[model samples]
Target: MDSLSEQQQQASEKPIINITGEKVALGPIRRDQVPLFYRWANDFNVLRTLHIPRPSTFEENLAFFERDVEDEKRRTVVHFTVYDRASLTPIGRVDLEEINHRDRRAEFGIEIGEPDYRGRGYGTEATRLMLDYAFTGLGLHNIGLYTWEYNLAAQAVYKKAGFREVGRRRQAKFMGGKLWDIIYMDCLSTEFVSPVLSKIMVPDEVRS
Candidate 1:
């Protein structure tokens, strides 16, 4: 990934049509990126934070993408591949899952699989970009997510980004040598404070 300053400079030069923030750009997942997704999905280090690691075969991973594409077509979810805007590199994936039109709510998930990219501001800004789209582009009222009890860093990011803990599933998981609860966090459109997608459409001056 490029330095934050370089990412900002690149964002200014790229077409604003890219659903991008200062550090990351969210683009539709492509066929070629499926393999990368496969690699990340099967990594124990990454899945451990979410749940017990399940190694997935390449064929299975490909099938998963196929299924997701179908779901997306049905408006079940809006998924995107995360990119480092400055370097134009695919780093991970993010999605607004289980989208309900009537309820105007969705579940959120993100994975920055590239170990080098983790802990960078990419995850943080990618989250904001997703929220902007969920609230403004999709006309959603509430967005929710769940993380493992040990994912304190992710928890902090959610709290700082306006997601409040709503509940916890007691002893729902066993990981890292202890019984851990699944923490639920949510953010309402009204509670989002970032200027990200605060407006649904880009103004004419900035759009081109």
Candidate 2:
């Protein structure tokens, strides 16, 4: 039997959406990249909305990279580090987590760790690129995600990427000694087939 590598599959197939003038690239996380990711995960601004544990040691972060990324079964839970093409550096990561092939769906998760990287539209662009890869490259039916209501910026990014708010879980998050609502959003392949999103996402230079 012949098996297609992930890169091969992505290159040969069509994607559900392609935001113009932007591209999303992925590769195995390097040892050097681990420290970068660790720094991002530890930053209070970036982790504020994440259900992550306390700041991780470099060793702990390395373990996490091994588990969620290296051990990921390519069939489900594909992970990728988001990179800025212009600057040629990893800025963040986006993934299709908890994928269910039987159901033909998966949940989306993303984070741009560098505080200097936030609010410049890279998050949305990275997301659009991933959505295209998930729907078109992987032949999936649905992609969805959950975000806290307080994360208005992230919610806006999701909305710009074609994810529509479909439901909400009241008081679903308890972090920093407080409860917050979790909003669920999703977009169908048909709903995201158009190129309407280009207007909402434009990239900025990655901070040095």
Q: Each prediction's Cα RMSD?
A: 7.1, 10.4
- Against the reference, the lDDT scores of all candidates come to 0.84, 0.74
Write candidate 1's Cα lDDT for 81-128 as tens digits.
Answer: 888988868888889999998999999998988999887778888888
lDDT of 2 by residue, 34-66 (tens): 888888878877777887657679888889887
Candidate 2's displacement at residue 171, Å, is 2.1
Backbone steric clashes in candidate 2, count: 1
How many Å off is the CA of 65 in candidate 2?
1.1
The prediction achieving the highest TM-score against the true structure is: 1
TM-scores for the candidates: 0.86, 0.77
Cα displacement (Å) at residue 47, model 1? 0.6
